[model samples]
Each structure stands twice: as structure tokens, then as C-alpha cells.
Target chain A: AQTVTQSQPEMSVQEAETVTLSCTYDTSESDYYLFWYKQPPSRQMILVIRQEAYKQQNATENRFSVNFQKAAKSFSLKISDSQLGDAAMYFCAYRSAVRYQGGSEKLVFGKGMKLTVNP
Target chain B: AAGVIQSPRHLIKEKRETATLKCYPIPRHDTVYWYQQGPGQDPQFLISFYEKMQSDKGSIPDRFSAQQFSDYHSELNMSSLELGDSALYFCASTQGWGRANEQFFGPGTRLTVL
Candidate 1:
């Protein structure tokens, strides 16, 4: 069984500043994927960024990027130049590279952390 | 690019009532996934379909069943619903079972049980 952990229940950052949300996971598999998802008040789940375990290089999407430490089993999201629109519930998720009984892999998510960007 | 579409963005049902939620995946997407998120909680995987076949199951309750259609659309049927079933239902899709393909999510359906 795999599990994701987001220790921070809530975090706040001033607009135009930077904030890093920490996440850790427990998985025996060496190959996997890590992801960050954002859910706004509209209740819509949006993919923020993804990091492949095989790729040591971090993944970045504009202001959103991930610091993936495979050996440490840590994947954290860093938001630079934060904006008010970034205020949302952020989730750290994990997916196995290996299939399950011929079934597709499903995402294992963390409890989630609320990110508040203050203007 | 068109994103996943979930119909009846908001639904209100009473206890023990039956509810059906629909999901239309992005064009050419062969995989569909369903997840449930309770108030102030993270989304939990319920089920998944690949090529219109059940590929995976998660924490879904026995009262809930889902299937993918020939058109790659999926429907989740919930029966004997409980107040606890009231939550946001999300539908996500991916093109293939690739190692790095990310699941694109829909706006989700908010089901409220009264």
C-alpha cells in the first residue's frame, strides 16, 4: 500500500512572495510519479504539476515547480511570485508505475493543505 | 483542447435516493476515473475504466457502481445514498496508461443529500 503525507494543514504567503508546501510518501516501488493538484472554492480539481520519479530533474510549470527527492521520498511544491488566484486546497498525490492486477494505476492522495495567498 | 465534462454540476438528493452522475472524457481519451471528496478532505479514488472496461477499484462503497460507455463516457450510479455520500464527485481522464500521463480533471459534480 502507498500513502502520501502533507504535514502542513494550512499555509499563508503574501502576494508576490514564495511559499513551499511539503509532502512525503511511503512507497516500496522505485518507479512512480508524484503530482500536485489544486482545488479552488469552485470545487474543481486542477492539475498543477507532475514529477516523474525516473527524472531527477525537477518539473516546473511557470510559477509552480516541484522539488522531488526520490531517496528521501519527498516531493514538495514551490510557488514563486504567488498570486491571490493561487489560494486553494493543494493536494500531494502519488501513482505507481506498475499496474495492479492488470488494472490501471490510481492516485493516492494526501490529506491536503490549504494555501492562502494574501494580497 | 476540451477538458473533461461532468453533467449536472450540482445535484440534490434525499436519503436512500438514487443518483446518476455522468462524465465525458476529453476527445481521444480512453481512460476514465472517478473520485469522491468529502467536505474538508482530499479526493479518494473510487473506480477507473480503461477502454470501457473496469480497470481498478478503490474505496467505493457497495452501493456505488460505475461503467464506461462505447463513447468513452462514464456514469456513476449510487443507490441507497446516505448523508455521508454527499460530497464532490470528480471525473478525470487520460489518453493512455503511459508512465507520465497526467489525469485531466473535470469541474466535478457537487451532490448534496438532505
Candidate 2:
């Protein structure tokens, strides 16, 4: 079973600064995918960025990027030039590349981290 | 292009009553998923449907059931609603059931059981 963990329950960053949300996972599979999702006050889930285990290069989406350390089983999301719109609950998720008999891809998510960007 | 659309943005039902939520996946998408979001918690996977068949079921009770039609529309039915079942239900769609692809989500339907 794959499990994702977000050690930081809450994080805060000033506007125009940077903030990194920590995430770790436990999985025996060598190939998989890691993702960061954001849920704002409206309670809508939005994808932030994704990192493929096979790619050593981290994934970057504008100001959002990921630092994926395969050896340490760590995948952290870094939000540069944070803005007030970045305030939301962020979740780290893991999905195994190996599919089961059902052919369904299930996402294992962490407890989540609440990010607050102060003006 | 339409993303994912969920009906009944908000619903209130009495205990033991049945509630059904609807979802319409984006055109051409082949997979549909249902998730539950509780207060102060991350969304938890409830079930996934592909090719009009149930592919997987999450750690939910037996009272929860889902069905997908030929048009790729899906419905979630809660047989006996409980207070614990009160939460936001989100629907998502993907082009395929691949771990590498990203899933698009809907705004979600909030259900309240009193």
C-alpha cells in the first residue's frame, strides 16, 4: 500500500516570498507519480503540479515547482513569489504505476497542509 | 470544453433518507471517479468507474453505490444517509485510467444530513 505524509499541518508565507510544503511517501514500487493539489475556500480541488518518478528533473508550473528526491522518498512543493491567492489547503498524493487486476488508478493522499499567504 | 459537472450543488436530507448525486464527465473522457471530502480533511477516493463498470471501491460502507451510463454520466446513491455521510462529494474525470495522467475535478456537491 502506498501512503503519503505531509508533516507540516500549517504554513504561512509573506507576499512575494517563497514557501515549500514538505511531503514524504512510502511505496515499494520503483515507478509512480506524485502530485500536489490545492483546495481553496470554495472547496474545489485543483491540481498544482505533478512529478514523474522516472524523471529526475523536477516539475515546474510557473511559480509552482516540485523538488522530488527519489532516494529519500520525498516530494516537496515550492511556491515562489507567493500571493494571497495561494492560501489554501494543499495535499500530496501518490499513485502506483503498477495497476491492479481492476485497472483502476487510485490516489493515496496525505492529511494535507493549510497554507496562508500574508499580505 | 466542459470540465466535470456535478449536480445538486447542495443537498439536505433527513436521516435514513436516500440521496443521489449526479456527475457528467468531460466529453471523450473514459474514466469517472467519486470522492468524499470531510471537514478539515483531504478528499478521499470513494469509487471509480470505467467503460460503464465499477473498477474499484474505496474504504466506504456498503450503503454507497454508483452507476455509470452509456453516455458517461454517473450517479452516486447513498442508501441510508447518516450524519457521517454529510460532506462534499466531488466528481472527476480523466482521459484514461493511467497513473501518469492528471484528473480534472468538478466544483463538488455538498450534502448535509440532519
The lDDT values for all models are: 0.92, 0.90
Span of ten consecutive residues with least summed lDDT in model 1 chain A: A96-105
In model 2, pairs of residues that clash are none
What interface RMSD does each of the candidate structures achieve?
2.5, 2.4
Encode model 1's per-residue lDDT on A1-119: one tens digit a residue.
98899999999999999999999999888788899999888888888998988899999999999899999999999999999999999999999885432324899999999999999
lDDT by residue (tens digit), candidate 1, B80-106: 989999899999999887446889999
After TM-score superposition, what is the CA distance of residue A29 in candidate 1 from its true location, in Å? 0.5
Q: Which residue runs of candidate 2 sit more than 4 Å off their true CA positions?
A: A98-104
Residue A65 in model 1: lDDT: 91
- Cα lDDT tens digits, model 2, A6-114, are 9999999999999999999998788888999999999888999989888999999999999999999999999999999999999999877644333337788899999
